[model samples]
Target: MNSEPANRRIVRAPRGTTLTARSWQTEAPLRMLMNNLDPEVAERPEDLVVYGGRGRAARNWEAFDRIVATLTDMSDAETLLVQSGKPVGVLATHPDAPRVLIANSNLVGKWATQEVFDALERQGLMMFGQMTAGSWTYIGSQGIIGGTFETFVEAGRQHYGGDLSGRWLLTGGLGGMGGAQPLAGVMAGCSVLAVEMRPAAIARRIESGYLDREAADLDEALRLIDEAKASGTAISVGLLGNAAEVYEEILARGDLPDLVTDQTAAHDPLQGYVPAGWTIDEWESRRERDPAGVIAAAKVSMARQVRAMLAFKARGVPVFDYGNNIRQMARDAGVEEAFDFPGFIAAYVRPQFCRGRTQFRWIALSGEAEDIRVSSEALKGVVSDPTFTRWIEMASERIRFQGLPSRSYWMGLADRVAAGLALNRMVAEGVVSAPIVVTRDHISSGSVASPNRESEGMLDGSDPVADWPMLNAMSACSSGATWVSLHHGGGTGIGFSQHAGFACVADGSDAAAAKIARVLGNDSSVAVFRHADAGYPEAVETARAEGLRRPYAEALRG
Candidate 1:
């Protein structure tokens, strides 16, 4: 082994005396071996070390033995090493030292058992493991998985501080699109100031019990906002109406902290409605031919609406545009008729009922057919007579100028009447082997006589006659070898409107019957059935037997 200089010889200290150079030198080799064997040993440059002279080998041997004995008597030592770099090697050495080392390890393998982790916890040691490469990877992987630094930075900012709760306001509570805005705002936890013009309409809304008790007009709404501001609540406002005066009034009040308007298409009446002749295919073709022109046209239209909305925005209000499917909206609004003929035909020929294919055939009387027709023609003669007027007038004062009825009431009534007439005509024409004529109690003029006795039936009883126009039209089709599938109408006891009827011809020969069956065969919101001839009770029974279904049962009950 190595030898030390005589001048550097270590002197032994007395028993229980503080450690001296000679004592440390004599005990150096044994202490070094013990430190090496001890897993808790520090690095060579940092930890204490000793050297011995050649003459002191015997003393060194004795000192080494004494040192080992002293160490055995002492308790295990604990040390805490805190460093910026990895202290894994230091930690591995002191496996049992109740020690802690803080560092980042990208791949933290299962190094410590449950017992060791518990021991570390007991010793109040916190080991923090953070990602080293600034990239996340599964074990045994090296490549990045679409890391975004900007997103990470933004996420960090949000986590530290981000305000989410802000006051919101919604305007307009009268027109279709505008009316729904306030309701939507209330659901989203925003304060709403519904500004409706018509007092009667507002009163109607109040009567309907849709609004809150505190809901009020513009003046009252402004008063509430003033009161809220006095109470120190931030108020944000949203406008939904097209009225420029109301928009200007809101701007002039100047109490709103934040204002937003849903004036998506305020400038033009045809803003969101597609022009009559444009189809999706044609639009796409035009888009390809002159993309810039198409864009400019769209921008011009949109810019006008935006400029109108910007009147409020210029007064420091924010605006929101709730856009919709323009083409679909136009079609629903009946503006599609203004389009080209092909487009108009496409819209008309589109399936009305989802499940069926029924072509509404328009028939006009010729010269001889018209000459033979009479205004007071009998119901049977009308069905058989081709001279009957093809165009039937179904008038409704309630129809809007927009060329659309308020609801489906008239259309549904017409369809039901047509079905009955077709069936009766088929039976008269011998197109069907069997024609079942079903009539409900409310529509039939016959007495409440049972079908069991034909002579007991009185043709001119209390019930109103069937809708003749629809019958006449169907009958014309039936006379041309088209079998009617079913016919139904009401009996004496009930009113005409309450009564329903249908006729069923044998299946094979009638194309109209096939179409009706195809249309009616699927699951639908509405169902038609053969009417009962006997009475109301019989009609109910017939309806039940036919398995007739209606989606809006509650609405129909009235």
Candidate 2:
């Protein structure tokens, strides 16, 4: 069986550097695992759901207990294997080997559909990983808020001459990853109107300080947004309604927002998105009893949403896909011009990828806010990138700690290595309180293959190739990452994506420092190498600038 979701409990991660396991390598993962299920961090911890359409941290309560027990008792020279979210075995490996290796939600290509996956889930044979969820790298909404904020700012720079004042962004979804949109939009100097289907999701975002206010209906939402737009003031308003319905309403009213995108779990129709007019209860009921019907209905709704989005695009508003595979679903559901607008990565974030820049994050093992504060300052000393410095300062002052005190910002390879080494040294020198575990979102430049997202619109037209993520995980293991994971159907839905996640523990020792250097450096090199092979001139130049020996990079660019 895949899981026993009925076994609900309160879970919290330990908040100190004291070893709960034999070493920091194992202990870090233990804390992160529990942190994924922390009441504040996860979306639905009682049901084992972390975020992104039922992505779970464990197969069940039983599996969680076993995994904790194994971590506590494991030797430094052994590695634990996890299948999906279930612990499968402990194998004899060297100390330099990853403390844990994981593979989640993978299926044969022909069988990678909602029907087959739902069957497997019902039979208890699989779990959805959804980027960082099952891989234990989730740091809550704070994890994505920085990237989201940056994306909005970039969009403004591209479309509005580096200013979003007096403009408003319209988007959907307010759970987990998507919840960051409201605050991020406000931070980017735009008013945001976020539509969320679930009532509780809206309330949660508000309580957690990610949202400014909730509107009783569409009129109030628009009024609030209009007030902000008139004054050129940054504000956010959450609307309690299905995005498809609300978007259609906005179109009917001819209220043209400056920019538009979406973040609904449209990648997983049956679980992630609700049909346009269906109540949550009816949607859930049909999802359980008639999965096929639910899929068909959701696709129809997705087509309608895409049609509305296309309408906005046709009217000259800057509209883009937010990488949830909604366009694919709409195209399959018979929307012919579904690809008219570009995805976010292609529209705004691909340049960063070209430089091997990623949303790199580090979590304090001590769970002390001071540890994160000190690390943030240390990171500034190491990277010196203006964006990094500004983001670190803003994050240090504005972000609220979720499960663990952590900080994230965009960094390229060399800066990542430098920061990793510096953080390791800090742990060793007691400049900070304890060790830090470094990780990144699996939706990265070189580690993900998703035609609608990370790898969309490649110069070489090789967006569907899945080999890069495998190589990424393999290299992470070989380069001494503390834990490495390979996942399927992350970001996009089943049969749509493959990616990897890795974590390196800097525990203040020489050995840990060496490992951190190798992993961070090698991982980014492979990342930029993928972009260079894709024929992006920026990637080729970055690769050459980094002194990577790629003899054919110039030829590929030419």
Candidate 3:
């Protein structure tokens, strides 16, 4: 990690000019791990929290140091075994084998609840590795911005005639993923009123340019929203108030915004959620001393919040849950109709997933914007898919590079590997400065079991079957991924989901080319197979068109 001895706090990965490890394979994991800790990439690096509620890059500082030391000295023939961010063992393996194999937050099904997980966690037995956090694949907030933008765009299409001019959106809880909502809504041409209790959270969004203004109260927030809407200007306003109370007040007045949703950390009641009437300080103190009390209070508050959201749906305004499992919390708190609204994924993202159009990210190892530009152009040159070509051009023009000058676009299985191989050739030809580090969410198809979110309402009802991600990880490692990981409790919280992820470095070598071709192709092919298996007609057509040898998919298609 890059650092000066005078100030040890700012740790970023070293960039420019060559490989430090024994080989590029070893170098990829080492640099990517440090990149995850870079101040620009991580949400809270000092605490090792990368993003989400408590998703960490490593188990602890000690573990982080050890992992770095291990990766620095380990050879390509020796594979490091990381269990929940701790490097526990090393074993000799073939060159094609992954340099690192990781399993994080895995627990027996019966013992997967938060109470048991916490006991083991405090004993240093496990850590919650939310999606890309522990897997060393996080591409910062921009990664999520694309998905959020798509949701609002879909909302506009469904309810606002494909345009959000002179429209406004109302949502709550501006934590990590939720913080993207304001910017996404504005980007889709709608003003947004985001209700968040924490002043620090509101300030963070404003500083990041995700929010345009912060209002003192609901009246001021409403005024700002109205003014922005009237001017046909998109803006985001952060309201300083409890989400539950704010939504309820709007419900009482029968003056609701055009859309409703939430991104509060309601997945974890004790830690992620703040109870109504409790100050941040009190909430923190009580979380340590009275967790049960905190959970109870938070559940009641979430119920009220969901009740108000249901009121918006009742009034015929589009309402959805932003994948925090807040509806479940409210339902558990005795609000029987809490699930009246759908999750954002179920509403807008699943169709894209069926077509294998999901978060496809690549990082510029050189950390140079020109490298990204060159690679994007290189990718655009080879692929004739007009959708992808247009997206590449639009992304390079519109999306600001965040945390390592990375870029992501949603492409299906058909052309994803084509793009990867094109970028690899560019790197080999010296058209770009460094290799592109490709990554995706841990919850890619055939690689996640989340009943409430990604796998919700599966045709075959395989949402709780946890073996898919395990199979996906094995496939990745066998297909020549530099590193492969399987994680539990990624997005929907502990015991709720299991997923896997992989990182492949494209360094412009024959070996790198072969690996990228196999990994990217197979990785995305599994998504097509997964959706085909689930009876998605589009996926079945894609599988046949791509010549994937899935007999069951063929039979199902027939």
State which candidate, 2 or 3, has the greater lDDT: 2
TM-scores of the candidates in the order shown: 0.22, 0.97, 0.94
| Tens-digit lDDT string for candidate 2 (1-558) | 123345547888888767888878899999999999999999989888999989999887778889999999898899999998899999999999999999999998988886788779889989888889999999999988877887899999999999999999999999898899998898889999999989999999988888999999999999998888787698899998988889999999999999999999899888889998899999999987898889899999999999999999999999989889999999999999999999999999999898988878999888888898877887777895777887777666667889888888888888888988999999999988888999988878889999989899998999899999999999999999999999999888889999998999988999999999999888888889999888799998998899986767555657
Q: Cα-based RMSD of the predictions, in order?
A: 41.0, 2.3, 2.3
Residue 1's lDDT in candidate 1: 15
lDDT of 3 by residue, 1-558 (tens): 444342366667768857767777777788788888887667778878887768888998778888988888888788999999899999999888899998999998999898998889889888878888899888776677778887898989988899998888888878767777887788778899988878988887787677789998788888887887777788899998888898899888777789898888788887787877889999989888988899899999999899989988989999998888899899999999887889877787777777766667888888788998877777776666676676666566555655678887766765678877888888889898878788776656667888877888777787677766777788899999999999988788887888999988888988888887888788877777787787889887777787889976456659
Those runs of model 1 whose alpha carbons end farther than 4 Å from true positions after fitting are 1-166, 207-210, 213-217, 226-242, 263-308, 324-558
C-alpha RMSD (angstroms) for model 3: 2.3
What total of clashing residue pairs does each candidate reach?
Answer: 27, 2, 0
Candidate 3 ranges with C-alpha deviation above 4 Å: 1-8, 383-399, 553-558
**What's model 2's overall lDDT?**
0.89
Of 1 and 2, which scores higher on lDDT? 2
Using TM-score as the yardstick, the better of models 2 and 3 is 2
- Candidates ranked, most accurate by TM-score first: 2, 3, 1
TM-score of 1: 0.22
Candidate 1 residue-wise lDDT at 271: 19
The lDDT leader among the candidates is: 2
